[model samples]
Target: MAQLGFEVRDLEIFASRTVADGTAAEIVHREHQTSVEVRDRDGLSFFVNTAEPLESDPAADGRLSVNMLWLTPDVPAAITDLSNIGARLLKTADNGHIADFAAKNSGKIMAHFAKTAAHGPLGFGYHGKVEELLERLLAAGIDAHLIDESYGRTLHITNPDFADQPSNPTGPTIWVNEEDQPDQYGYTAPSGTAPQAARLDRDSN
Candidate 1:
């Protein structure tokens, strides 16, 4: 979100989707590929892209799983703080692996998604409190998008100031929450646990 600091790719200047006058209105952002960037407190960042459901069937929704984890010296504490604001902890990092601490791993890091969305036998619909989860990132100057997945919204955070944005002295650690049980995007959940955020380079398939 340009308003929040996350580099909103192809974001319309006047409006995200449209611009209108008293009697005139038009679509300013005519279907730009939705994308964005998210950064952590230490200044490291990652990119995310918009996604759609695997099934054409409306009843079939999807969920997201962690592909890799990014870590920092203070990641556990940082993420715990995030949980208080929003990133509701489904599972703590107890299940994930930890990477060696170093300069490259000094900054905050998060899991890279492997399967962003998971379809299920019965795709029941439920509202996940998506906005609340990523709202904290706003304070960190990292704007994120609640991508439309039909059933709900999915996050697609990219580096907004990646190449030129000023360094943020303070930014929150934000992670993408993709779920199949309830739906994707827009915070709300089945109370699944999340692994501790870690550095991806240290992780192996």
Candidate 2:
């Protein structure tokens, strides 16, 4: 973890996916499970989890799935690390904001990395118009939703492969946000001082 410049913030465990999402918190109080929260040098923490039987497929190979998006300061260095471990490069953003890779011969993206930015850890996105993408998805008979956010316009679509259960109507979804989105981090007050500038400075300390 230290070699990768990652910091472990906290660890948590949940009985099921719904419990982890706060949906089944009242019905299911406890169960055998565990999870760890890890963050890169940029302070974006993502969870590595182990939930009960219902949350995930026990026999499925999870390596073929892309679950989290990690941010790194050095995109080339991060790509080198993945290549060193036999991971195959799938695609890279022309603007150097994102990189997708597959871990094995499965030909499926297992991990994704985005450039460090001020939009928080959820800043993973691509270069395109959100409205255009939404229209394309809807025209293709896919269920998609759009949100106009201050940071940028975002679109989320349900995973076509996800098996929706009664307990969880919305099984799994993907986020499609405009790349290089604007955020409060780039703001400067009229007095010539930025509010979030101080926060960023303190966070670095």
Candidate 3:
């Protein structure tokens, strides 16, 4: 059997106020086992489901209760059953919802190819919205690092010297000179300054 993963796409929110208070309680109780349902809106209707599982807990007041729900993929149902439930049979697409959900929740998604590199094959499957998720992370001020297939690691160079140091010492390495001295020479003064400048000034005079 193929392993199944759930992805949530669009979601709809319903509060007790949307329906008669008594009807709301009845509906909640009747639909406890059902994740997807058709809700009547001013005689029009739409299908709705929780993005995730729902749970109910007793409130501080003994007589009251609170419930939480999430929307996710729905199990395949017969068209007749769905129609009897008053739900319109909207078309279903491939599992992009999983990627969308991951992007929204984690602020990052990984393509299958990229994911395989960072994590071995046994790791979680990659979602296709990695680039969008990365943009979201960057906009939120979170550092988004990408590990390409060629390099299966996120590289961060925190040390100034580390960035300038030669990887193999085959050629000259570049360094930042914050103090106005030649970084290559390790000298305290510029070659054109002090005695050199004085001698040139003397010669010109």
The lDDT per prediction is: 0.32, 0.41, 0.25
Candidate 2's C-alpha runs over 4 A off are 1-68, 71-124, 164-171, 182-205
Top candidate on lDDT is 2
- Candidate 3 clashes between residue pairs 3 or more apart in a chain or in different chains: 50-70, 50-71, 51-70, 51-71, 51-72, 52-70, 52-71
C-alpha positional error of residue 201 in candidate 3 after TM-score superposition, expressed in Å: 92
Error of 1 at 171 (Å): 30
User: Estimated TM-score per prediction?
Assistant: 0.25, 0.32, 0.17
Give per-residue CA lDDT, model 3, range 1-205, as digits (tens).
1111112322222323223222121122233533223332112222334456546455422221111111223222222222232222222223322111121222111122121112111122222334444565568775544444321222221223334754422113211111111222212222343311011010111
Kindly give the stretch of ten consecutive residues in candidate 2 with the minimal lDDT sum.
196-205
lDDT of 2 by residue, 43-132 (tens): 443333432234667975332222234456766555554443334455565455555554321222223344452222222244456777
Q: Candidate 3 overall Cα lDDT vs. reference?
A: 0.25
TM-score of predicted structure 2: 0.32
Off by over 4 Å in 1: 1-32, 56-66, 77-86, 93-205
Better of 1 and 3 by lDDT: 1
**Candidate 2 lDDT:** 0.41
Ten contiguous residues with the weakest lDDT in model 3: 195-204
Ranking by lDDT: 2, 1, 3
